[model samples]
Target: MTQRQPRRAYDEQGREIPPPTLADLRAEGDRTAFVHCDATGCGHEATISTDQFPAEMPFPDIALPLRCAACGSKEVGVMRDVVGIYARPRERTGWGMT
Candidate 1:
């Protein structure tokens, strides 16, 4: 069977956004993910949120054509938290000084 390719991510007005960077994350209010560039010695990494996308959006389904700022390579990978992290109140004893 053939695999289905994911559609490009769009903005509020339905305009296609490339690479889905920090700007897209802020607009969506989604949690964070690490974007890794696939260029040798490039080591470019970025944390971006996925708020605008559906909750069930797969990692492989993210918008492609991602380019590395360091090496100008077009290969990239996205990594997300396997477990969700929660916030705690300042008054909580578990956390020390603010």
Candidate 2:
């Protein structure tokens, strides 16, 4: 893994918003971000909430310690995930049908 750069974060307006800090994430209220593996032949991805991170840290700093679980590579990227964070959970009935 070459430690590729992370993808740019975008907001609902398609505007590349968000400062490179944890405070910005907390202010937005949607603390979700997508973690991606940049290693060859490994495209592992996961949705993580900011709760996993302690306060008083920048967003990009997390990438340094992150690794692709599938390939065990230090090459990974973090992108602010804004789509499903605000989605309403489906209402399931007796049979668990949506």
Q: Highest TM-score: which candidate?
A: 2
Clash counts for the predictions, in order: 1, 0
Q: Which residue pairs of candidate 1 clash?
A: 30-51
Q: Summarize candidate 2's per-residue lDDT along 1-98 as a digit string, tens digits.
A: 33333444566666665446777677756577788998888899988777777666778766777878788999898777745544524442224322
For residues 1-98, write the lDDT of model 1, one tens digit per residue.
Answer: 33323445556776655544445444444376667887778889886556655655454455364567778887787665332222324354466443
| Per-residue lDDT value at 45 in model 1 | 84
Question: Could you tell me the TM-score of candidate 2?
Answer: 0.62
Candidate 1 wrongly placed segments (more than 4 Å): 1-30, 52-56, 82-98
**Residue 66's C-alpha lDDT in candidate 2?**
80
Looking at candidate 1, the ten consecutive residues that score lowest on lDDT are 81-90
User: Stretches of candidate 2 above 4 Å error?
Assistant: 1-18, 85-98
